[model samples]
Target chain A: MLVVSLIAFVMFRFVGDPVDQMVGLETTLEERAKLREQLGLNDPLPVQFWNFVSKAAQGDLGISYQFKRPVAVLLSERLPATLELSFVSALFALLAGIPMGVYTALRRESFLSKLFLTVSLIGISLPTFLIGILLIFIFSVNLQWLPSFGRGQVVDLGWWTTGFLTVSGLKALILPSITLGLFQMTLIMRLVRSEMLEVLRTDYIKFARARGLKDRAIHFGHALKNTLIPVITITGLQLGSIIAFAIITETVFQWPGMGLLFLQAVQNVDIPIMSAYLLLIAFLFVAINLIVDLLYVVVDPRIRIGGAEA
Target chain B: MSDALLSVRDLVVEFPTRKGILTAVDSVSFDIGRGEVLGVVGESGAGKSMTGSAIIGLIEPPGHIAGGSIELAGERIDNLPLEAMRKVRGKRIGMVFQDPLTSLNPLYTIAEQLIETIRTHLKLSERDARERAIGLLDEVGIPAASRRIDDYPHQFSGGMRQRVVIALALCAEPELVIADEPTTALDVSVQSQIIDVLKNMCAEHGSSVMLITHDMGVIAEAADRVAVMYAGRLAEIGPVRDVIQDARHPYTKGLMGSIPTLMHDSDRLTQIPGSMPRLTDIPPGCAFSPRCPKAFDRCFSVQPACERHEDREVACLLYDEGGRP
Candidate 1:
C-alpha cells in the first residue's frame, strides 16, 4: 500500500500544478508564493511523500484539488456505487459462468454449447466501452426501457448511500454492470470449461464412473469441486481488477462511482484523489489475493496439508 | 460354464481412428466362476486391460464393444442400456484400476467416497453405509479403519489407498471384481501385500476376481486359473498349475519361458523374439506367428480357433484335432 501510494504521489505530483488549478489569474506573484507555502509545496520530495503516507495511514487523504473537500469523504460517497455495480457483476459472472462452463465442457458438440462458446468469444473480444455504448443504444435509445446515464436515485443511510433501496437506482445499475461484467463472465466460463474438461479425463473421474456414480454426482461433486480450486484464484483476482478498472464502464454510463471521480480528478490534475485511488486499488488487490490463498485450503485438501506444513 | 459367474464370448473392442479401425480386443473369451480367481497375464497393449474395461462397459467413446456377449449369473448384460449398465457396474461387477494414486478422488474423504458407492448400489441408510464402509476398510486390512475413514485419499500412502479402493469395490459385495493391474504402481515390497489383501477380501466376500497383470509371479500366487493373451487374443487358458507347468500354445510356452525361475541356472532369461504386434499391424493369421518358434504353414495361412487339449484350451494349429496337419 505504501509503495503504491508513493508511486501515485510521485507520478501525479508532476502533472500540471495543484496551485495553478486552485488559483485565479488576478492573484499576484506574492500571493501565489504565499499559497504555495501555505500548501507546503515548497517542502522537499521526501517530506511531501512522508506527509502523504502518514496522513493516508490516519484515514485523511488530504483534500481534493478540484472539490476542495476531504478525499476520503469523496471516496466514501462514491465507493458504494462502484461496489454495488461490481458486486452484482461478480455475482452474475460466477452464478452464470460456472454452469455455462460445465455445460460447454460436458456437451461440447451440442448446438447450444456451440452457441454459448460463440457468445462468450464475442464477450471476450468486445471492449467494455463499446459494449456499454451498444447496450445504451439498444436499451436506452431504442427501447427507452432503461435510463442511459447517472445513478438514478440514491438513498442515504448513515453516510453509506445505496441505490438498492430505490427501484430507479436498481434499474440504472443494469447496463453498466453487464458491460463491466461480460468480459469477466466469459473469462470465468472459458476457464471453468477448460478446467472441467481436464478434470473429466483424469483417472479419478473414470474410476468414479466405474463406481456407478450418477452423472450429476460425478460431474458436479467430483469434477466441478476439483475445477473450482483454480477458478477461485482467478475469480478473486478478477474481482480486484473489476473494481480498479470500472473507470470505462463508469464513464460510458456516467454512474456516480469512484471511477468517474478519478477521471475528473485526472482531468483537473487532482493529485490527492488520484493517489488515493491507486492506493485503494493496490490495497484491494493484495487483500483479494490473501482471500484467494485462504480459499485454496478450503477447496483442496492437498493444499490444506501444505498450508499446515508451511 | 454353468457354474461360471461371469462369461464373455467373442468380445471385440475397436477404436475407429482417421487412419482405420484399431481392434483393441479381438474375439476374446473367458470365464470367472463364483469365488474363483482368474488371472489375465499379458504384455502392455495386449488388450488385457481393454477386455476388463469392456466387461464393465467403461470403454471410452468411439472405442466400444464392437461384437460381444457378456453374461453375469445367466443374464445377458452386453446389450443393457447405459443406465442399466451403470447399475451393473458397481453393484454386480466392481473395478479396481492400476494406479491407486490417481484412482480415488483426492478431494473427498475415504468415508465420503465409500459411503456414496455403498448407497448407490445398495439400499443403505447413511449410518448403515458408514458402518459398512468402515467394515470393508477393516476387511481390506486398513488398520484404524474407523478413525482413518474420514481422511482424504492423499493422506493415505499408495498401498493404503489401494486397500481403500479394494474396500470401495467390495462395499456392496459385488459378485465379481475386475482388478486391472492392482499392484503395478506399488513398491515391490508392497505389491505382494496388496495382492494378498485383494485375494483375502475377495475370498471373504465370495466375489470372483479377474486379476489382470503382466507379472507372472503375481498370477502364480493369486490366480486359480490363468489366461495368457497375445495381441488382443487369448493364446492359452487353464488351471494355473497346468498352464504354468505345461503351457500348450507356443505363445504361452514362450511367455512361461520368459518368467525368471530360481530353479533354472540359465545365464539369461528367455525373452520372446519380438514385441507384441500393434493393433494396426496384426498379422493376418496368428498375431504371434511371426514370433512363434513353432509356426508351421497353417499357422501363417489361417487363424486358429481355440481347441480343447488334455486339460486346457489352446489357440494354435498345433493343438488342432489332427495335431498340426
Candidate 2:
C-alpha cells in the first residue's frame, strides 16, 4: 500500500502541471504564480509528496479543482455504482462460467461444447468497447428493449441508494453489465474448464467413481470442489481487472460510476481525484488477495491446516 | 469353487489404438470363494492390475472388456448398465487402489468419505452411517478412531492413510474387495502392519479379496491361493503353498527362483532371461515362450491350453501330459 501511494505520487507529479489545467493559458504569469503558491505547487517534490501522504492517511483527499468538491464526497457517490456493477458482473461470471466450464470439460468433444468454446473465444478476444457497442446496437437500437446508457432512476434509500430497484433500471444495467462481464466470464470459464479437466483425471476422482458416487456428486461435489482453489485465485484477480476494465464500459455506456469519474478527472488533470482513485484501486486489489487467501482455507482442509499451523 | 462369491471367466480386455487393438488381459479365468484371498502376482504390465480393474468394471476409456463375463453371487455383472453397475460397485464390490493418497479425497475428512460411501450403498441414517464409519476405522486398527475420523487424509501418515482407505473400502460391507498393490506405496516398516489390518478386517467382514501386486512376499503373507500372470496370460493358479513350493509352469518356476530365501544365500538372485513383451508385440503362440528357458518347437508353435493336474492348473505344454513331472 505504501509503495502504491509512492508510485501514484511520483507518477502524478511527472504528468503535466495541474496548475495549467486549473488556470487557462490566457492567465497572466503573476496570477498563475499566486494560484500555484496557494495550492503549494511551489514546494519541493519531497515536501509535496509528504503532504499528500499525510493528508491521505487521514482520508482527507483535497478538493477537485474541476468540481470544487472534496474528492472523498465525489468518490462516495460514484464508488457504489462501480461496486454494484463489479459485484453483479462478477457474480454472473462465476455462476455461469463455473457450470459451463464443468460441462465443457466433461464433454470436450461434443458439438455444443465446441460452440461454447468458440463463443467464449470471441468473448475473450473481442475488445470491451466493441462488445458494448454491439450489445447496445442489438438490444437498444435494434430491439428497442433496453436503455442505451446511464444508470436508471436512483432510489434514495435511507442508508444506501441504487438504480437496480425498478424495471427500467434493471433493463439499463443489462447491456453494460453483460458487455463488462463477458470477458471475465470467458476468462473464468476457460480457467475452470482447464482446471476441471486436470482435477477430473486425478486419482481421487477415479476413487470417487470406484466408491459408487453418482455422476453429479463426482463432478460437482468432488471434482468441482477440488478445482476451486485455482478458480478462486483467478476469479479474485479477474475481479480487480473487471473494475479496471469497467472504465471502458462505463465510458461507452455513459454510466455514472467511478470509472467515468476517473476519466473525467484525468481529462481535467484533477490530481486529487486521480490520486484518490489510484489509492483506492490499490487497496481493493490488496483486499481481494487477502479474501482469496482466506477462501483457500475454506475450500481445502489441507490449506486450513497450514493456515492454522502458521 | 461351485460356491464362489466372485467368478471371472475367459476375460479379455483390449485397448484400441491407431495401430491396432492391444490385448491387455487374454482369456484370464479365476474364482474366489466366500472369505477367500486370491493374490494376483506379475511383473509390471503383466496385466495383474488390469485384471483387477476389469473385474471391477473400472477399465479406462478405449480399454474395455472385449469378451467373457464376471459374476458376483451367481448374478452376471459384466453386461449390467452403468447405473446398475454403480450400485453394485460399492455395495457389492469395493476397490483399494495402489496409492492411498490417490484413493482418498484430500479435501474431505475421513468421516465424511466413509459416511458418504456407507450411506450411498446402505440405507443408513447419517448418525448410523457415522457410527459405522468409526467402527470400521477402529476395526482397521486406527487409534482414537472417533477423533481421527474428522481428520483429513494429509493429517494421517502413509500407513495410517492406507488403513483409512481399507476402512473406506469395507465401510459398506461389500461381498468382494479388489486391492491393487494396496501396500506398495508405504514404507517397509508399515507395509506388514497395513497388510495385516487389511487381511484381518476383510476376513472379519466375510468378504472375498483379489490382491494384486508385483511383490511375491506380500502374496506369500496374504494369499490363500495365488494366480501368476505373464504377458497378460494366466500362467498358473493353485493354492499358495502348492504354487510357491511346486510351480509347474516354467515362468512360475523362474519367478519362484528369483525370490531371495535366507537359506539359499547367493551373490545374485535368479533372473528370467527376457522381459515381458509389450501388448502390441506379444509373440505368436505362447507369449512366454520367447523368455522361457525350456522353450522348444512345440512350445513356440502352440498356445497351450490350461491343463489340470491334481488340485492346480498350469498353462504349459510341459504339463500337457496327465502325470506330474
True contacts kept of each: 0.81, 0.74
Off by over 4 Å in 1: B323-325
Clashing pairs in 1: none
Candidate 1 local lDDT, B64-162, one digit each (tens): 889979999999988899899999988889999999999999999999999999999999999999998988888888899999999899889999999
TM-score of chain B of each: 0.98, 0.97
* Chain A alone, TM-score per model: 0.96, 0.94
lDDT, candidate 2, at A217: 86
Model 1's DockQ score = 0.86
- The residue pairs in collision within model 2 are none
Which candidate gets the maximum TM-score versus the true structure?
1
Model 1 reaches an interface RMSD of 0.7
